[model samples]
Target: MKLALRKIRLLVHLLHGMWVVATRFPKATVQQRDALNRAWSLRFLQLAGMRLVVHNDAARLDEGVLVVSNHISWIDIYVINAWRPTRFVSKAEVRQWPVVGWLAEQLGTVFLQREKRSDAKRIMHELADHLVAGHAICVFPEGTTSDGRELLPFHANLFQATVSASRPVQPICLYYEDAHGNQSTAPAYIDDLSLGESLDALLRGAPLTAHVYVCDPLAPGAERRVLAAEAQAAVQQALDRLQPVTARPAREAVGVQPPEPRVDVPHASHAGDAPAANGPLTQ
Candidate 1:
């Protein structure tokens, strides 16, 4: 297909998604919302000119669970939603992003102001409530996106709420691949690139694939920090096997250093607080 024609078709799909979001999405019931989230996210990926490759080993959740993963790009949300519906705890700035923001809010994303320590309490409380109420929630514990090549030290505080509520933590590993199956930068929203810039790169390049690997869920431990470390290790090991080392400019062992303990959360919940728990899952 001609590049121009593909882009034109992509634009139409994008506009149609926007229309649905503006009209029916916000008014939808929970089931309806889940359907719409999957549909809209799939369409959004098509519009953005990327493909999704998911390998889910996640255990079936009959009740609400906490979803934790590394942050990479805005596309991560769409990729995950294309699989199942879950509310995400995102930064407050996302609410201002024109059309996208409205769609995100309708999809039930919880916002937190990262700068405010107090906001952590409120956000964690809400997340715990949702978990207890049987609603799945996702959190990016790295606190921000990495270059899609390197992993970041995860913030442990995010796990406290779920641990406190006795909810299990599910870790997912994400990778981007090129049409040739090599790790690709075609979809990296890293560095200082704007959303439009990322979109342009995706549309103009070879088809990109977003790969998701679901790790074994870590049961709530005595300490949130230990749980966070164990989760990070799970994700890192998965990446080591699945993500090609040649894809990155850095050395093979990425994000393997013991991160300086930077727990910035007020202690309130969970005998699950991690002092660390270990799970046996590898890529």
Candidate 2:
């Protein structure tokens, strides 16, 4: 029954989305467009049973900056847009995702063809132009999703755009968790999975909490490699700080012997994600 409701909700959303794509986009201003996009994206998550939590060093991000984040799932874009209205630098294939693709094109997503190395140079200039025009652009520098397990080495080439635009780059770390506050695999969208297959995984019992950690922004500099490495480390450290606690071996749980003690970061309090439901999968 939950799955049936999910399918019904998606059909309604796609119909409304198509109407927006055909009618509203032709006449909306940039602000108007993003406002509408934000509304839809947030509601889309709610209806899909995903809860969003945003924690940023600053109260809100500036309009024209570069956001670097680890890729996890297609919903990652919406989770960010739920807080900040921005464009994305995505691969060319996302532009082919039927109804969703058309909406993304209208929302100003820049597409990159990874097969052509020169395309990266072209996209760098394109992103820089957008930044110069005061648009926030996001890039998944790892070039692929790791299902929230590892931080892949960032492709430094994308950072060149931030340098060219002289825009500050901010790193955000994300993970999805079930009701029990542990990492959940229900939404993992990796490896040969079709969109329909992914949606099926996401539509199970309840919503998932999207854990977001926003770090301080890095000043753009000439060395893209150094910038990339710094951003990677910031996210890795954030992941370490936020990852779920692991249980000790079976013997320790049974109290046959004392378990090895561990140290943890000391803080008076932590800002945790608000309520959201989740099933069991990975993306």
Candidate 3:
């Protein structure tokens, strides 16, 4: 019954979205139109049972900026879109997902082919064009999803897009909370769980909450590698300070381990990170 309601809501949203796209395609500036479209997407996610907590830093986010964020659950896209207008730099396979693929295309997502070295230049060029056109593009530099307890090291390659375009890179942190107010562990790896299993877990879990923190955009002129590292550090700091206090039993919580001693610059990026675009969106 819930699934049936969700389908009905999605169909309504799709129809409304198509109407808006057709009506405003020629009249509205890209920013104005995208802001409205993204807002609707966010509202749909909220109706689908995702709660959002957002923190906006000093960054104005005006003009074209490369927004870097950590990936956690499949719904991170909706969480991000709820707050601002932005396009995503995703894996090419997302261009084929069922309804999601259609939505992504409408959102103007830039699809990357990571396995093909030759595609890097093309992806970079496409990214540069988006920046030049004054569109905000979101990239998951960690290149994959994690359990929300720690951040993965960002891939320096995507930072090159910001460097080449001479645009600021905004760092964002995302954390997902479970029913017991703890981080979820079931949906980290794309290959670790089947779609049915993941959906079941989400449906059975307590209302999921996503916390989003936007840090100041990095200044231009720094090395892309240094910029990436700095962004990674900022995101880690936000996560450390903002993770909600969990009330779940120790054995049942996903991130119940004791906090470690503080370090000046803790390693946020985990090793052996998988590609970000590998799950249902890719299929």
Q: Rate the local accuracy (lDDT) of all candidates.
A: 0.68, 0.69, 0.65
RMSD of each: 11.2, 8.2, 9.0
- From the highest lDDT down, the ranking of the candidates is 2, 1, 3
Question: Clashing residue pairs in candidate 1, if any?
Answer: 221-272, 222-272, 222-273, 223-272, 223-273, 223-274, 224-273, 224-274, 226-276
Superposition TM-score, candidate 3 onto the true structure: 0.77
* TM-scores for candidates 1 onward, in order: 0.81, 0.83, 0.77
- Residue 67 alpha-carbon offset, candidate 1, angstroms: 0.9
Best by TM-score: 2
Query: Which ten residues in a row are the worst by lDDT in model 1?
Result: 274-283
Q: Specify the poorest-scoring 10-residue window by lDDT in model 2.
A: 272-281
Q: Best to worst by TM-score, what's the order? A: 2, 1, 3
Predict model 3's lDDT versus the native.
Answer: 0.65
Leading candidate by lDDT: 2
**CA deviation > 4 Å runs, candidate 3:** 1-27, 185-189, 244-283
Show the colliding residue pairs in model 3: 152-269, 153-269
Better of 1 and 2 by TM-score: 2
- Which stretches of candidate 2 lie above 4 Å from their native place? 57-59, 247-283
